[model samples]
Target: MYYNTNILKSTDGESICYYRWQANPDVPFKGIVQIAHGLGEHAGRYNHIAHLLQEEGYSVYANDHRAHGKTAEIKRLFGYYDGKEYFDDCIADMYALTNLMRAENPNSKFILFGHSMGSLLSRKYVIKYGKELDALILSGTASFIKVLGTIGLVTASTVKTFKGRERGNAFLKDFFFGEFNKKFKPNRTKLDWISTDEAQVDLFEKDPYRTEDFSLGVFLDIIKNSKKVNSPEAFKATPKELPILMFSGDKDPVGEMGKGVTRVAKQYEKYGISDFTFKLYKGGRHEMLNEINAEAVEQEIISWLNQRI
Candidate 1:
């Protein structure tokens, strides 16, 4: 599989860049897999996953959000996006790109896969654009408690008054994710929460596009959107028939040892979602796709997609 990079002009005047990977033309494609990557990472990181999906006759697409990855590196939109509705712009970007690609490949279904922060955004995406997709897959995701979200609002609002949005701040990252590496006390790298695979962690560390920090505004937007997704109202508008797979690591701190991930899945059920399932990978961490047993994780997801799509 080959990754073809392209830039599309967004409705909001910003240019969005994406990677499109098509399956072998000799075989009929099953559908389109459009991925929304997590924060501090780029779309290019999913190339390996794209190739795997392509082998199964699925054309995969992953886009860099406004201020991350190749889009940010080339356009210089790192650490911050252009507007206050940072989260809104991200969903809009996905909506635009998904429609464009779906138009070109109208014969097959569309499966939206989101990881980590991308997973949080996908929760919003499925609710708003549920009718547009055939299936949804969420990885490395969690349900955010309202109180924690409120704290984020207060902290970010106070921090912005003093530090502003244009500049990067390490305060939130240290405070929120600082404990991730504590479990792996003898770990060689700070991003040990990502994966036990040292090679993958090293690649992530060396990547220039993967910035280690984010702006206060960006963090607040994440917390707010996360709260929105976990709330009961988020899924009221979603189509019950939309097949969703919510999978996370049992040991992932982000998901609170699978408790919040389960709540997220249960919240969807409470709101009338009827065609979804949740799973936890034993010994898995935050980045299940990049974990030591990543191949098994990828195979399992592919199986699930085949069953639904």
Candidate 2:
């Protein structure tokens, strides 16, 4: 399957770049998959997953959010997006791409798949836009502690005051993610928590786009939005009828080694979510889709989607 790189003008007048993998014309189209990639990564990295989905009759769309990947390169907004409501703006950008996807495939179901930071955004997205989605899949997701999030936000806010929002702050970055590497002792790389597959970790380390340090504003927005999504109100706002699937690696520090994912699932239950499921891949790290058993992980997603669609 071939993908076309396209551009969409965002609500704020920023050009959002995305890759669209069209489903097979011969087979009956099943659904549309919109992928929200993790922080510091581009939409093109998901091409392998897109190809698999395209073969399975699912058209895939993954966009580079503002200040990340191709969108950042094109706009020269490398670290931080303009404006205060960063989280809301990111969600809006995703929605814009989603609108385009739905327009092209009106008859198909819509599945939102988000990874890592994207997973956090997707959690918030379902709260506001759950009615529009047929299903939601969250990978490397966590149920962030409100108190910790508050502290992080406060620190980031303070730092943003001293250091410009667009400029990266090493202290803040280390304060949050520095411990991720510690979990993997004899750490060959700083991002060993990303995947056990050394090749994938190397690809990430070598990629200029992925290696760029995000600004303090990015951290602030993430914590702020994470707090919002995990709130009681956000839980109440989520459409109970929306089917949700949360998956993470047992060894993924982002999910607190699966504990945080379980907490999220429990929270969903507490909120009266009618349909919800979660899975933890044994010995898997943060990016299970890029893990050693990635093929199996991919199959799990395909099978789950097949059952639902």
Candidate 3:
């Protein structure tokens, strides 16, 4: 596949930045993979995966979620939201992008792949639109932690009440995400847990679009929506045959060191979702795509998708 960029207007009346890897013109596309990226990262970061998929004759697409990446850098949004239903806008962006891709390539089966925050959004996506897609893949995922989320919600509320919606707070960043790197003792950087690859970690740190201090409004939005998607009622509503694949590293705190990942799978099991697959990579970390053994992980993903498709 080859790479290119384009822009489309989202429902919020802002131009969305997106990237695509087109399948080889000489080869038939096996399917389409539309990625919903994690928080604090841009769609462009998946170029390596997209290139691999293109070689495999699969068209791949990814968009910068609102208030992040190039989308955030845009002058109109400037990495801020109105503190009202911002999470809903994030879901709607994926929905809009899906529709556009479907229209462009009607015959292709569209698969949803989400990581971290994107995985959370994908949980919400499957609840509402599971029947519309072929499969779902979640990486660096976990079931919600109500206690911590509650604390975050209170923090966001207090900050928003005092400083207003547009204000970014370092407290939320430290309180919620500060400990991720702590688990990796003598860590070179606060993000060593993301992947073992030092170069990738450095790249992520230097990336301009990688968010540092999140505003109170967006922080609360993550907690609020996470609670919504992690509900049993939400899991019960998803179609039984909607194939789901979730993988995380055993050391990933985001996945609660793999406990939360299993919980999510078991929740679906309770709901009678038959076609579910999960894995906890031994000695792995949060960002499996950028992990030291990412090639093996990618092959595993390919094998799973092949079986499902």
Off by over 4 Å in 1: 145-150
The C-alpha lDDT values of all candidates are 0.83, 0.85, 0.84
- Please give the lDDT score for candidate 3: 0.84
Ranking the candidates on lDDT from highest down gives: 2, 3, 1
TM-score of each: 0.94, 0.95, 0.95
Candidate 2 local lDDT, residue 113: 96
Q: What is the per-residue lDDT of model 1 for residues 1-309, given as tens digits with 9 covering 90 to 100?
A: 378999887887778899999886877679999999988899998988899899889998888987788778776757765477788999899988988887888868999999999998888888778887899999999788555566667888788788786566676777666665776778788888887788989999898898657767788788878878776777786788899888999888788777778787777878777788888988888898898999988999999999887
lDDT by residue (tens digit), candidate 3, 1-309: 257888888887877888889887777678889999987788999998888878777889899987788877776454576647767888888888988888888978889999999998888888888998899999998788767778888878888888887777888888877767788889798788798889889999998778766556777888888888889888998889988898999989888888888888889889998888888899888999998899999999988987777
lDDT of 2 by residue, 160-214 (tens): 7887677787876776666677889988988898999999999988987773467
Q: Which consecutive 10 residues in model 1 have the weakest lDDT in total? A: 145-154
Cα-based lDDT at residue 113, candidate 3: 95
Higher-scoring candidate on lDDT, 1 or 3: 3
